[model samples]
Target chain A: MIMKQFRFEPLAQASYLIGCPRAKEAVIIDPIDDLGAETYVLEAADLGLTITGVFETHVHADYISCARELAEMNDVPHYLHESATDLVQYSFTPFKDGQVFEVGGVRIKTLHTPGHTPEHTSFLVTDTARTDEPWCVLTGDALFVGDVGRPDLLLGDQALDVMDEATRAETLYRSVKDRLFALPDHVEVYPCHYGGSTCGGVNMSGKAASTIAFEKRFNLAMRKDTPEAFAAFVKETAKPFPDDYARIKSYNLGLISKDAITEAAV
Target chain B: MKPTEVQDAVAKGAVVLDMRPPKPFAKEHVPGAVNFQFNRADLAERAEMSLPQDLTYIVHAEPDPIAKVAIGILSKAGFSVDGYLEGGLKQWKADGLPTEALPLLTVDELKDGLDRYHVVDTRESFEFRFGHVPGSTCLEWTEPWDQMEGLESEKPLALVCGDQVRSAYVASVMQRAKMDAALVFGGMVDWLERGYPVEKSPKKAKAPRI
Candidate 1:
């Protein structure tokens, strides 16, 4: 499998271009809207790959996603969790939990890891030629290097079926403990944001990647032994919500037109 | 042909024509198998240019159709062909046949054994201008496999890019061309994050010392 990470310094956001070079095909995950669709298209071409799909881990609140634009531009499917189909305005291919797809020698399995937001997903990638075990996981916003995504973003929001902060925090804990922590110790963890990003709780690492073992050993969120404890940690560390999140989320959900997203809004 | 039959045919001096992409072929394949990727447009031409027509060959490819396509192309190229392996390498492995793998080096392993490798930085010159492995040769990942320079050495080539993705692809193709190349998983990002020594000035790919 071929994978490249593109980092947006200002927002501390990261997007990935993962491909199977032999198959000459690739996919973009969590593309930033301001990055422009052509950036990925040209980048993939330079690597001798064609963009075949686009995926969003969740309806992001911090920034808009270019998943729709990239998918439409490439004439490929835009994938989101089945639970998000009704919540968003645009059309997409709704994938269920544990759904697996192949791009040549690379196999990507979707794990429904909802916590930060209800429809969040993570991609577990395997290079079948090398090993049946997953080589790395794209943890979207669920699990970061030293911190996990904050679950309080949707608290009191107008988005569909909003949950309270405590309940969402508990769900995130379970998702991390049961779904993410279950992976092998050596599996590399690549999250969407890192240090200086508003998405994760305080203590997020400046490092871009970490092994599951390292994260398990040092991550503050993972140290919490119980869901209640984890919820309390989240509440204790919650920072003031960014004022532009609602506008960003609305644009991402396609609730508003592209024109509605002014330069000042982002 | 069934997996067991492929083994029998192999014993009778039939060559296994692996029709998968270079990466899978590099990672694992039948012992003594020759890879001619099914996706290559010049599969028949490349095979005809290199392979002996008198020898019988068996196709090993996945999804069944890929194997069939290779077989058809070989037959048209006037090569004597045996039937394809029933379930490709997956079935071959299931039947307990032996396979081989190329090296996939982690950043730490590459650092520890730097002397044993001809470190090839596959990142672009612009990216390489910032920082790269000390004494590494800069050969952009997009450089055609045959056109790549500074790789002919007693030491195995260790391929690196900003991340492992580009180097992995280059290493796959390099292995397919029968070069002694190992992919540096996580590449320069991992190397830099680990605080390894780096050369800020870019170096051009030069012919290897005799």
Candidate 2:
């Protein structure tokens, strides 16, 4: 199995390309607009792998996703959480929780870890050539380096009907503590954002990667003994939404054209 | 058994048991290989139905660990599993042994060629009852040869399940018996995802918990 992390320092966003060398097939996760489709395709070709599938953790409120562009270019399937059926205008293969997609000896299993955004998902990846046990989890924005994703992204946004801040925080807490934390301690953690990214709380570590055990022991968000306390902690660490948060989200949902967002920025 | 030894075993009338799912087996496999997918639950039952005890067997599965587990399962199930092929199918291919393939029909193809095939849903009875391909006949994986024998032999049997794994296993078994069979890639899940119509059982029945 071969894994590559493409980190966009400008947005503090990280995307991954994982593939099975023997099968010569790869899947891109949470591709960002900055890097574009060609970057993934060219890199995969250089590595002797064909881009077989594209996956999105969720509709990003922070930035535009290149999932559609990449998937279309390769004529591969774009996989997203099934809950996004009504929200997303683009074509995708809606994946349910526990759905497994295999690329040669590497198997990717989906875990619906909502709360960061209602349709948020984390991918549990196993390299069957090495072992059946998952070697690492692509946590998306649910579980970060030292903190959790800001559940308050949708707090005051009225463009879409979404969960309130309090409910989202509580749900995010359960998603982290109950679901993500249940992974074996040794499993490596790779998240979409780190410190300096508004998507995560203030305490998020700048370190790109950590382990499940390390985060469980030291993450401030997980230290809370109860969900109520966890919610309170999450709410307190909320950051101000970016000026174009709604538009960026809308762009991701295909609600508005990319040209509209770019023109608005100019 | 090593790839070099596969021919010797075959010459002596030993069957090559391919433990991988039907998809890979259908794509390419040691000619005359029988597929009985390796899994913990019901391995013994499925083996009993799919395999003949009279012949000695050579187990073949990819990734050495799974092949090891398959050998253990076959041994415990009271079958004569001589040994597993070292380095699995990769090594077998590297050794340049001849292989064969079965048809792997996509949902789109199945949709277009519905009239030409006999669709068989290999999912559980309750799952089949809940929703299934309009004309598919439900025959769960564990169903015996007598049940499969009732299938329309005139038309090519197209096997399908939730995902294609179970269907692929069933396809391999049918192919071993010289039946004209094809594995429905992406299975019923793909069919439903494509918004294809399905026929549900008139009476709603609860699926039994495993």
Candidate 3:
């Protein structure tokens, strides 16, 4: 298994490229932009690996996600949770809660982890060739080091008439406490966003990944077992909402095409 | 030379570089001049950071040859040199021109008295996060009403930036706002050059606590 994490310091975003150099196949998770081509793709080509899958851990609120753009350019299967179809206008294969994808010797299972957002999903990865045991979990915004994702960022966006910050917080609490924590402590956990960032502006960890056991012991959010306590922590730790997050969502949904800006014909 | 010309140039946003050692500079010098040793090691590296590339620079140093050399150093590195003070500080003094100085603090003094003063970084949030004074707050640049919130008008502020250029501007803004804020002399360049500890915010430094 060849796993590399790429972090954009300015945006506090992290993307991953997990490859099977043995099978010459790979996949990317939570990509930020087309800059991946210059970085991970070049690295993949050098390793003689073909990318078979791409994923958006969730519809990003800070910067635009390039999952669709990279998928189109590379002609790979892009996947996202089915729940995001109404909020994001991108075409992708939807992986349900319990679906699993096997690429090369790796088994990537989808855990419909929602809380950071309704469509957020996490992947439990196992190197099947080595053993039946799982290796890691890509937690996305559902969980972070030192803190879990801030669920209150959804406030004031009326597009989701059924969802609000409090409701999101409730869902997030359930997702982290019930769904993600259900995994074994030995499983290595990799999540996007890390320290030195705002509550909403999560960055990547220094080590790139931490053990589920370590996070369970060290993360402040994990200590609070009740959903109410977790939601309160999310509210208290929140920063001023990220600037221009709504408009960036429009770009991700393909509603604001670059062609429209250059006045090019559709 | 007319004093008004120097004032006009300064008013138009030229950085005044004083190339005298700290001892001489402290007694008397240009009102907002930043001091860097005239001939010292790492002067080039310091200049690249502490000095702004955009604005013109007016150098004040000793004798004609040395002053020209100082200007040459900056000019070689793509800095805009508007030229040196024709007669230098001694001549300016002889002409009964205005000169002033403030009580200077070494990094040691600032660290010892850290609690007595406030540290404000004028760098953008990203730059500050890369590394900064642990307890300092950020006020990148300010709007008319910006000071009302982020700034503590009561506390003495020591303003710093990537280079002194932005902080120098911020110092003036603080003055107009009636806030007591001084440039951190050489800014981040000097701080890093001195090898003081820099801190990263946990929000951005999100390593697992365990």
Best-matching candidate per lDDT: 2
Query: Residues A12-72, candidate 3, lDDT per residue (tens digit)?
Result: 6778988764455789888886354445554454344556778878877666677876676
Task: State in Å the error of residue A101, model 1.
Answer: 0.7
| Interface DockQ per candidate | 0.03, 0.01, 0.01
lDDT of residue A262 for candidate 1: 77
lDDT over C-alpha atoms for residue B127 of model 2: 89
- Tell me the tens digit of each residue's lDDT in model 2 across A1-266: 99999999888899999997666679999999898876776566545465789999988989888899888776689999999887778779999999999998899999999888889999999999889899999999999999999887872555454787777888888999888899999999999998788898789888989999999999998899987898888778867675687888889998899998888888
TM-score of each: 0.57, 0.57, 0.53
Candidate 3 chain B lowest-lDDT run of ten: B201-210
In terms of DockQ, the best-performing candidate is 1
| Candidate 2: residue B102 lDDT (0-100) | 79
- CA lDDT scores, all candidates in order: 0.80, 0.82, 0.68
RMSD of 3: 22.7
Candidate 1 accuracy as lDDT: 0.80
- Docking category of candidate 3: incorrect
What TM value does the first chain of each candidate achieve?
0.96, 0.97, 0.90
The best-first sequence of candidates by DockQ reads 1, 2, 3
